[model samples]
Target: MVDKPKFNTALHEKDGVNQPESFSASSIANITKLRRKQPTATELVQGILNGNKTALSRAITLVESTNPSHLEKATNVINQCLPHANKSVRIGITGVPGVGKSTFIEAFGKHLTGTGRKVAVLAVDPSSSMSHGSILGDKTRMEELVKDENAYIRPSASGDTLGGVARKTREAIILCEACGFDTIIIETVGVGQSETAVHSMVDFFLLLKIAGAGDELQGIKRGIMEMADLIVINKADGDNIKKAKLAKTEFNRALHLFPAKNSGWQPKVTTCSAINHDGIADVWQIVSEYFEMAKGNHYFNAKRAEQNSYWLTETINEQLKSSFYTREGIAPLLEQYKKAVQNNELSPFAAAQFLLEKYFSK
Candidate 1:
């Protein structure tokens, strides 16, 4: 069993967790004091920039927390890291549950670290809130990778989203890149076909699948399959190796049937066994090949630019809605307006105008 101190030390080095010690009552108190002190966003940003893992983890926690005061700090931290961001490869991994995502990532991360690359994994499973728990368990499953000097694993901070990825996974990516992690892998919360949130934020989107899930071509709903850069058939070892090969062949043929993605990168399908660590290196090679091809075609930079633009527009729209609804006494007015609109006493446009008028009059 990995001792708590060693685990904390490994993660601390990767994330900048300062003053690592055994978790005790004093440790809890110290963290509480830090929270109470509420270091200015600048101090927090400096800590993060200095690669203080504790501070980085705490900053993410603040961003993920429900506390309104922490929102300002979180935004500041992201802004500080923004210019240094977008340099890393953000790969989103998603599949149905039991597709060996966590296992595959552990092996894949090890492979990257071995090749002198720094890897950071953000397991996004915001649906975890409904269960009040993390679904994929990346930290526990990737124990070896977690202990590696060149790897970082951050669990999904709970959020109100169908895909367990937190709303701030984008922000986390920025911070990860700023911390010098070259490969940022995001694992989506798999529950049916709603894992598309990860697709938009990543440079390469990978979909994992088991060999004989009956329907080899499990055309995922919500159009997510159209977004995949690569499809991996995991669990390719054991007596299932031949079946896995067939599955890969089936998926490759299925992929050809679809129109190429808007990015002009044709999705590649391959098979792997995460349990025995088979074909892991080949998987990384495919990702690198995609990068080279996309870079040459000018799709790589274009995709990141597009992602940033979308996030900015979406953030502004969400902020506008939030600011309108959260004002004091706005709840009652909102309720009143809802009923008026429902009863045809007012059109939605008229009701919105009235709300705006009232809000500004105050």
Candidate 2:
């Protein structure tokens, strides 16, 4: 028999009894000392430009924060990074629930990273009422991509946003692009108007659908289908392969009925098994071809310019609403108006005009 080595352990005395020591004040102090100070906006911008993941994450957090003080710093960071942005390809992926979005993203991200492309996935998850945070964690689902050195995954909470995207997602994209991520994937919450919001921000919108479900066409809105630049029937392996093919054919026929897109690019439908990594490259190839065609026709730059103008107007409207609603007197007045409207004592238009008058007078 071989002799076993004995390892020394620190002991602590409790009630005249010896126990293995778990923690020490000195160790806690050392940990506190080792914690890094928060980087300034300028430092974050410089660090992100240098491809530092930690700095990029910190900058995103700053942008996501609702804190009034952090807003200026976040704006500064985005402005500094704006010149470096727009160099990467932005793709939006959306689907109904249980459509294997995480699995698809993991495989898709791996494929891009394998080709030496730095990929960043911004996954918007449904928010919780209790915590007001994202509940569907993407990190655990995307195990492979989570471990990939070239891949970055962020799960954002769809906090009261009907479109299933975080308010600061656009700013986050700029930071990712500044950090040299060549491929950016925005995964929507897959409910309500989220698909439209994602479509506005991304260059390519890919809608993932499953086959064999009787309600396939019924569940997806026709508007979403029209927005899709490419439709993919995921989970096509084994028994599902035949069904997936049929669904693809059905979608192809349906797409032809819609009028041609302004970009002059025809939408394509295909099938793939995200779990088995089948047709992943074909999806990327299609995306590449779309980019090539859009750029050739100068539609890519034109679309982005339009999107910028849209966001500018959107930001102003949001800020105006926020400023008005958050005034000290607004809440009480709103409660009073709510009762009056419910009792049919005051018309909604009159109440709204009254509130606006009161707000401006103050």
CA error at residue 92 for candidate 1, angstroms: 0.4
- Report the lDDT of model 1 for residue 117: 95
RMSD of 1: 11.8
| Strongest candidate by TM-score | 2
lDDT of 2: 0.90
For model 2, residues 182-275, the per-residue Cα lDDT tens digits are: 8999999886564667788999999999999874676344788889999999999999999988888888888898889999999999889999
Model 1 regions more than 4 Å off: 1-35, 126-136, 220-222, 333-362
Give the CA lDDT, 0 to 100, for residue 168 in model 2.
84
- Clash counts per candidate, in order, are 13, 1
Rate residue 233 of model 2 by lDDT: 93
TM-score of 1: 0.82
